[model samples]
Target: MATLLYGPQHDPIHIEDRALAHLKIVIATKLRRNETFTLSWKHPEAEPGGRSTIWIHPSIPLRFVFDEPEAPQINVRWVEELMHTANSSGGIMLVDEVLDIGEIERQH
Candidate 1:
């Protein structure tokens, strides 16, 4: 698992290391251009049944931590889908479903 600490008020969002790595890429790209958007995801079972949303801004303090030392292979299709959501007015809402990290690499 990986942890994404956003600001000081919200609890850390736990995500799989693979997804976090790619999310890091997508998020960094937007923030680099000073684009702000909402990121929503289903809360972990421990957090009950609701979803969580955070306003992602360039000014906020954000941290991404990966459990593994090596980075996961980037899934281009997954990233494109995620970016599409991020670009929408509804913003980026992550589904609990995770893509197979190896699946993309094997094709190339």
Candidate 2:
């Protein structure tokens, strides 16, 4: 699992390493352009049965930590999907990756 330490409180949001890798790209792109958005996700099974949303801003401190020593192969399609939603008024909604076999094969 990977962890996203966001904002000054540094609340830890656990995500799969591959998913976090993709989210990092989308989040960085938006922040770079000085765009602010919300990230919503369902609480993990270990947590209470509910969902959470956070307002992401450029000024806020954010960090991505991966348990793995190396970063996983990023799925470009997944990033694009995330970027698309990040632009929406509803903001970015965390969803499972729709793996592109062709993309994975190309990466190998």
Best by TM-score: 2
Q: Which residue pairs show collisions in model 1? A: none
Which digits, one per residue and each the tens of the lDDT, describe model 2 over residues 1-108? 889999888879998888888999999999989999999988888888999999999888999999998888777788888889899998998888967878669769
Off by over 4 Å in 2: 101-108
lDDT of each residue in 37-70, candidate 1, tens digit only: 9998887776679887889999999999889999
Query: All models: lDDT?
Result: 0.84, 0.89
Candidate 1 matches the true fold with a TM-score of 0.84
What is the TM-score of each predicted model, taking all chains together? 0.84, 0.89
Error of 2 at 41 (Å): 0.9
Task: Tell me the deviation in Å of residue 30 in model 1.
Answer: 0.7
TM-score of 2: 0.89
Per-prediction tally of clashes: 0, 0
